[model samples]
Target: MLNAIEMILICLVAQAALTDLALRKIPNVLILSGLLLALILHLLSGQPGAPLSQWLAGGCAGFFLFLPLYLLRGMAAGDVKLMAMVGAFVGPWQAVQIAALSAQLGGAMALWMWWRYSSKVSVGIPYGVAIALGTVGVVAWRHH
Candidate 1:
């Protein structure tokens, strides 16, 4: 059985993936709600160590890591927010891993799409799919 955190992460990633694929936009409501829920979960977990503190650190890590890409126009603000929400679930180090893995998946998908649809005028990538897959991959790897 999946725990609360895993279920929440899966839901967040799935919702983001669907909206991003369909509309090319990640909604603020989804991201903000995910963030709030993650913080609440962390606070409620009440582990020996400060889970909320770790979550905050993770959120910062995710925000800063993707901020550069957003500033450079390589990524969107919604994507950055989505990642920060993810970081709020995982810790800083795991968020870094998720980001790295997602980037690689996104890059590969872009390359494949470009190659396969060279004639298309626009081959925009749905990056949230990559993030979702990456999150799944990391979770599986960690739990294994």
Candidate 2:
């Protein structure tokens, strides 16, 4: 019983994850499109508690939450932007939860990669995968 927003979120994250895995980069066009779609959907839905302010706040929350990692060079700009796009779809609170879950998943992936590579890992992990999985988990859980 996924709504249009949920469906679109799934598609956006799936595409982002695949692109990041294949090219090690998430494209700006993808993020922009998601953001634009989110805005339109939110405006059209007229759902309570989903005002334009919430949308902007959610995007800001997601961006700021990941900004430190980007500044430290621990992650790419694409990851940050992807998170912001996700927040635009969800909201500030769910975005926070997704960020936490994504961080945990990304850390686990990093550890596994380090161990599997004998601590000589050269390439960055596709963190968009973690973000995608986390977002889906949170959204599904909320629906449940």
Clashes of each: 0, 0
Candidate 2 local lDDT, 26-91, one digit each (tens)? 999999999999988998888776756667888999999999999999999999999999999888
Q: CA shift at 78, candidate 1, in angstroms?
A: 0.8
Quick one: best lDDT, which candidate? Answer: 2
For each candidate in the order shown, give its overall lDDT on alpha carbons: 0.88, 0.93
In lDDT terms, how accurate is model 2? 0.93
TM-score, prediction 2: 0.95
TM-score of 1: 0.93
Residue runs of model 1 more than 4 Å from their true location after superposition: 48-51
Name model 2 segments beyond 4 Å from true.
Answer: 48-51
TM-score of each: 0.93, 0.95
Best by TM-score: 2
**Model 1 Cα lDDT, one tens digit per residue, 12-100:** 89999999999998999999998888888888898756465668888898888889989998888888888898988897998999999
